[model samples]
Target: MLMTERRAVVTGGCKGIGAAIATRLEADGLSVVRADLPAAAGAWRAGGGTAVDVDVSDTRSVDAMIAAAVGLLGGLDVMVNNAGVAEQRARVDAMPDSDWDRVISVNLGGAFRCTRAAFDHLRASGHGAVVSLSSTWGLGGVPGYAAYCASKAGIIGLTRAMAADGGPFNIRVNAVSPGYVANDMGGSLDGLDAEAAARAWAGRDLQASFQPLGRQCDVAEIAAAVSFLVSDQASFVTGTVLPVDGGQSNRLNTGEQQWPAP
Candidate 1:
């Protein structure tokens, strides 16, 4: 069976990679429910996915969102742990405990909450899959992104642990680590309209110069990978950090080499 046919819930599904995951899942024939911040309902529904206002970090909201999604889709086969919050750039020395906690709560705690809430529905369905969104920055150092890095890195660890826990029940857990995607948090493009950001990344082609792919990846590509990981086709796959990045994580995009001096 393809992805769209499955009943899936994607948190943070109103925009960016979360939206892309929900869209791709829908394309694959899966009924999709998108749990996003309240303001995103109109946009989520407009895309043919059911939208619910949810703060994945909150236990009550997480429970409600999962229940609502199960109600809307008739049961759950997949849960994409894609909702996340990133902290502002700050020196590690100066980063507040609140900042660290906030990042941890949303990125790591949200995944825990959502997965916990959806466990029964997923297990009963027999092919329960959980795919989380992670970042290459989580694997390595990026100046000014200490808190963000810690949170995402924690996700990778959590994914592995979940895989072990869910294996007995036949639920597979995996994560996708994205690098240099043209999004507000992922690349040089911040606060720009999505179209402009896409154009700039594709037009500039800086991703390959250092990333090995020489291009920024669109959200769809990563979503497709996530979809595959959750699909039956990957039945044997579990407890992996699948890097959707074009090897950029291996070679940090340091700077342009000025071989030709002025």
Candidate 2:
């Protein structure tokens, strides 16, 4: 039987940006299988969607995840590499080897594993697409995010290289680079109380001086970019990193800029 509907797998899809992406894709009529860690999977209430368990950092786990998704969804058309982690901010001099390895294994290696595992399936779909999550920090640098920045920057490199490889197979690969988003992962606000989190969020707003949009991005906004890249609307697009960073990536944030009155 010909499956007319598209099928997708979203890593780290149980919550935050991944969840938003899964929900958005579902709304677009794709059958989505949300994959998170085994621990987090226990808490997933997929509602009308499907959920699975896999640790992106583990190759065996990632392979099992792809197999499970194929079994449940019948096939895969889109792969959203959104699973990642961030630890306490520390300067490079103080960063531990364990922290760097953990972040790289999950954030960068996970994307590579997932994409590679799904390569054959995507080729068979004849319209396979991949949208990975990068960050504005990936484009440049942050003082205390050595491992994180390296991992995300690696995603951009991986995206472009894989796009080239997938092109011959009719599989499009791209990435979305987002700016400061108020999420449990990116902003170091996971364990803070409401008041403290609010203050932290407020502090990040200083980017408004250089950011055109003048604020942080919502998860849904980032998901929208993922949605477009996966859809036929972007059939011709590949090997590109789309910035969902409110124009933050367009200019260097050297310091406060003085603009003439318009």
Candidate 3:
């Protein structure tokens, strides 16, 4: 299908990585509909994209958002399930049930609701694609992100299952797992004092040593990956988890190892 003839819906499309994906899709010549919280309506309008107020955790809201997207765009060709939330740093034992439930509901459950709502339109398009955001933390465990990790991991599983189900309709489903990108969510040095923040930022060299690429992923880089997965080039690509995490997923931390004079 031609880019100009495509229509896409991106949840959480008002800021951060979501905004980047929406912008990339728009640049690719697709009519983009950005569905975010009502508070983000202004940002979405400022970006000159059609905005829909949506709370992915709410079934009624999700259905309304999908209906609006389809109505506005005439049909849906791509669905980007980018809406998600993270809990404050806490171990599973210490975490509140509300925190866990909220994270799962918005991150994993939201993707499921959005995907299900868009299924018919996607199937009708015959060249439809869905890309859900997963995280590198989802692939492995992080010390204090139990809820967030579980939700993202669930998205990966859901993506695979949806791929199998959507295959008959020629709809592609995939997940993009991004490593730490410098965004509000990833770059947060929250709760740290100025000195601590500075020290942490200065220790980027040490942090980079743990990952093969020696740097954090960028929002645009991740968006580029999404662009490909939703485009004709990746027509044959589905039921796969693409990691854009600078090799963080496969890296092993050896901790301060030095070569003796190579």
* Local distance difference test, each candidate: 0.85, 0.89, 0.89
Instruction: State the lDDT of candidate 1 residue by residue for 1-262, as single tens digits.
Output: 4755579999888888888888898888889888998878777577665799899778999999998889888999999998887777888998899988888999999999999999998899888999998888899888887888988998999999999999998999999999877564433477678998788766546544566665677889999899899888899999999998888776745587424434
Cα error of candidate 3 at position 237, Å:
0.7
Model 2: how far residue 40 lies from native, Å: 2.3
Q: Model 2: residues >4 Å from true position, as ranges?
A: 1-4, 46-49, 257-262
Report residue 90 deviation for candidate 1 (angstroms).
0.5
Angstrom error of the Cα, residue 39, model 2: value is: 2.8
**Candidate 1 lDDT for residue 204:** 47
Provide the lDDT at 1 for model 2.
18
**Higher-scoring candidate on lDDT, 1 or 3:** 3
lDDT at 155 for candidate 1?
90
Model 2 lDDT at residue 72: 94
lDDT of 3 at 81: 97
Question: How many angstroms is residue 112 displaced in model 3 relative to the true structure, after the best TM-score fit?
Answer: 0.1
What RMSD does each model have against the real structure?
4.0, 2.7, 2.5
